[model samples]
Target: MYRILIADDEPMIRKGLQKLVEQSGQSMTSIRTAENGFHALQQIQEERPDFVFTDIRMPKMDGLELCRQLAELDSDIQIVVISGYGDFEYAQKCLSYGVKEYLLKPVSKKAVHDVLDKLVRVSARQRTDTFVPVSRLEQWIAEMDDLVWSLREPELELLLEKLRKELHHYSLKLARFCDVLEELNLLLAKRLSTRDVFSLQTHLDLGGARDVEEAWSRFAEGIWSIVRDLKARRKGRAKDPVEEAKHYIEEHLAEEVSLEEVAEYIGLNASYFSQLFKQSTQETFVQYRTRRRMEKAKKLLQQPHYRITDISGEVGYADHPHFTKTFKKYTGFLPSEYRQNLGIE
Candidate 1:
């Protein structure tokens, strides 16, 4: 029992879209049409429809303005914009105002049906409160972190496959799906100690990704490329000094290790090592060391036998207040709070 409204100056275009929706066989309590954005706004105020489809160019107000108004009035209302090739820029602006879908002019029946199907699925999920939770997202990030750290190619592929299925099942909005990909990118970058040279924004061409399938294909390819590059580099002839540095850091987690100390251990000058480390890893030597220490602290916090002060010292933090502040910043939880969440006494 959902209400839908279509707004367009062109009578034929409005009628065609209405017919297309009706022909798609999706259940709707009512289907209304308006001649322009002003009329559409009036209709929306009188009866807030669950969905809106408006042409970019209308009489009183344009689709972009209409979208802005609707967003302010009701954040939950799903909006789809109808635009021509010339309105491409306007369409992108509409997205920022919470328009969920866009249809190019000469909209095909198949495209309309596809958009409707996605809206229906998303609406159903909203009703059921089935969106992916924050805890589940964190769990996924942790699993990805482990996979990247281990450098297990097969396992990583399997994980990506499962992730792809989850993305499809959720039928998330394009922006939300991209946000997840960005998080995965950052997690992999940090774990691999590599700079994010392959960000989705710069590396992947996802502008044409109208559906989950298209977007995921490009995203998966980008991830696979990163994996392949890392494997090839690992097997390359030159020994990786960054890997050696990481090993030294791990071994000296309980001690204060300086850049000069690690550089001397790896037989490189301190200044050269600092630059090389940043080039190989996205983070500087100090940032990497701090992250490793925080990760170790998280693990130790899970053990009830370890006192908070002892754990802090074990991870190179001599000051208890400093340790608590750093731990809270790193994990969004104080050490004690983290342990309590784990049910560890």
Candidate 2:
């Protein structure tokens, strides 16, 4: 039920009608009163109600004058002229001033209830026609932002379809479309403002859109671009622990670095890094380090000036004996034999 304002000179009439309207429909329906037509107009100007019921014979300004002024003020406000059977002609005159219903002086509960039902139907039609609240519009824009952030394409499609249908419910004006576009743009912009790269305003402008479909096209494209850029940025910047560990190992091959040290250097837990290293390189850390040491020893052995004993210490070995033993195992010959074989070659 709609909000109602009851206008009458008689105190009992205003109170009785207010009580009837309150009981006739819903407790939610707000009912206000005025002593005369002049006071009723003043209250309406302050705050417009959905419906007005005024007595035909009132002091200061009569109900006929109120109806006339209300027609000029807002034709949409549903008006019901109230008067006795003796003033039926006076009440009928209110019809030309946009008054539709009439309430007889001896008011009945049934009469008020019937009038409320009629007013409710008219109110329902007006609500659906072109009366979406600003708060509700903001809520819709907020939901759109949520979908965009999560990159929910399927759900976004459905939301866009819902918004498209709303286009018919409202006036098809470019200004209103621009308002929605701007609100959505600002919301996303604020959400991503802390990020280093990408700006929604630079990516798309819905101001040039001729209609709702075009505006949606531009908006969706901009959002998809942001999603793509976000995905690309994440993929490109992702750290590779194994590759970093391998590079560190290759650089410090001669140095005796433990598996735990390498894991610490790469910011990984020791036990987890051990498994990852084996999976990535197919060799334990010690095995890989020993293999690299042996390979480095062979390179030093080829250069005769760098003695085998010096190469032993250079390759992280404590003694020449250990290095020779490990070298023979790796190359199928002792370090001296490998040197001799290279000389013969």
Candidate 3:
């Protein structure tokens, strides 16, 4: 449901817009009204509605000026100009500010309904189709709220892998997006989400981000709210013990380790941990660790500077025969076969 703000100097016009929004077929949760632009700006700053409808000619500030101030505050806020026919030029100017719709007064219920319909549909598409969630697109907000955050290369890599699982729901667009995300650094990666693009662009346009770290914190928080909610929905929990285990496995891929030892470290019994890990990650602990080792071995094999035995050992295998057997079991080929397939001499 979209939240709407109505700003008109005339009480009847404001009330009429609010009634149109409430009676419209589309869902609109909240309606706030202000008699003038200054009051409208105050209300907007406080509540931050999804859609704003303001008359172009008001006593205190007017719709165009209010729209300009809102653009300064957040480029994402949608503004709809309620204007007289003579105010076409003013409405045209507000277009550069990203106003959603403009309706001529005396406004009809149908006209307001049409504007609300467009706002709801466009907003919904932007929310679902975009990489970032609509509500919490600011990373700093999520960080301050004590949500999960990722910025460092290794942490971001882990996040990308998790996002892969998430992309199953949005697979069509996610393929290209995930590829782009794979190569982006912390700041660039945060900016990749289309929902943040406008706001970040505005931030860059104004001046240099003096408190980049603080801004990053806010942006990370926003990303986390989406991921955390999705994680909660699919997994039925806010925290995933399996994800924790996967992180440990990735960190320790080069060390000789076993599920039993990992279970001991985390204070869970081996059998239970194995079940939960498989449930969360869709791979058993043994399979996950073995795959990590194979991935590392593949990277090392590409070097050609390292012997197979040394590479296998470097990835936690002590016995050459056992390592080859497990690698073949997982990859459907021996280590040499994998290297040869890559055309590596």
Candidate 4:
């Protein structure tokens, strides 16, 4: 649920916004009002609502000055200015404050709802860090499969673990994660054994990964060629059993998560899955999950709307210190430091 603060001198305007926020849905719980910008700042300091709606013209401090002061306090605070005057200079000043969006006074309920919807969408995308399209995960999975097929026993174990951690941390699906692994295993054990070097080259010619897109196509074509060669020598590919396991990890990141539990989710024997996963990704599943959780913690920390405790839980860290330790290991800065730097940048 989101906490909202409405700061307007007019009693009627404040009541109207309060009712509108309630009517928006159950996602909003705490709704507070301040008669002026000064009170608004004090309420914000004490409560720290996720969003603030204030009238540009207020007693003591105007919305522009209030936003300026609020940014000094917490730059990440979302401010929407509401004023009947609609001065261009005031609106221009808001951009400097990093206000996400602004609203003119004579506030319409529809306008408020529109802004809220936009905020939710931005928040959701930011949470996922879906910077790379969801489609890209499949490609990375394919690349992991190819890399795994060419490696020997000990080396394979190390690589697989690394891949597993990266996948889990990034929240890639288990089925997709496992499918590429399985495909590589099948190709390496069977195809690579009997095929000659020239024969393997012929295979690469099919979807020659010559171009940038094809080079990083995220498919097992390049790896399948090696498997084709090994299989001819009567070397058979090992079947990847961890396909279902990766999906389980991603779906349950917020819960009590561990490699053993992840293995159990896909009905795999724990020790075997751990070994195979390590062989394929060159990382332990635990390391990858922690890395990812910390990344999320970093992003969430950058948003002032979320407290450290909430961020800890949100990113799958059981304790703040633990989260802090892992976060610093991955990014050199504590979560709070990372956030503070982000504001300055």
In order of appearance, the predictions have TM-scores of: 0.38, 0.43, 0.43, 0.37
RMSD of each: 19.0, 14.8, 16.0, 28.6
The local lDDT score (0 to 100) that residue 307 gets in candidate 1 is 96
Q: After superposing candidate 4, which stretches have Cα over 4 Å from the reference?
A: 130-345
CA lDDT of each prediction against the hidden true structure: 0.78, 0.75, 0.65, 0.63
Pitting candidate 1 against candidate 4, the one with the higher lDDT is 1
**If the candidates were sorted by their lDDT against the true structure, best first, what order would they fall in?**
1, 2, 3, 4
Which digits, one per residue and each the tens of the lDDT, describe model 2 over residues 1-345?
456899999999889998898787454446899999899988886556778999988889999999998887666788988889999997899879978898886989999999888887876676555555767767776787667545576887888778768765676444345455556666667655533233434245653344567677777677777766654533432246677777788788767788888876765557767887888889998888888888888888888788778888888887678888888889999888998899933
Angstrom error at residue 229, model 2: 34
Per-residue lDDT for 55-98 in model 4, tens only?
Answer: 88889878888888877765545677776664746666877887
| Model 3 regions more than 4 Å off | 132-345
lDDT of 3 by residue, 9-30 (tens): 9998888888888889777668
lDDT (Cα) of model 4: 0.63
Model 1 lDDT, full chain set: 0.78
Pairs in steric clash, model 1? none
Our model 2 lands, by Cα RMSD against the true structure, at: 14.8
Query: Per-residue lDDT tens digits of candidate 1, residues 181-252?
Result: 656665555644443222222255454344456667877787767655544544432245688889989999
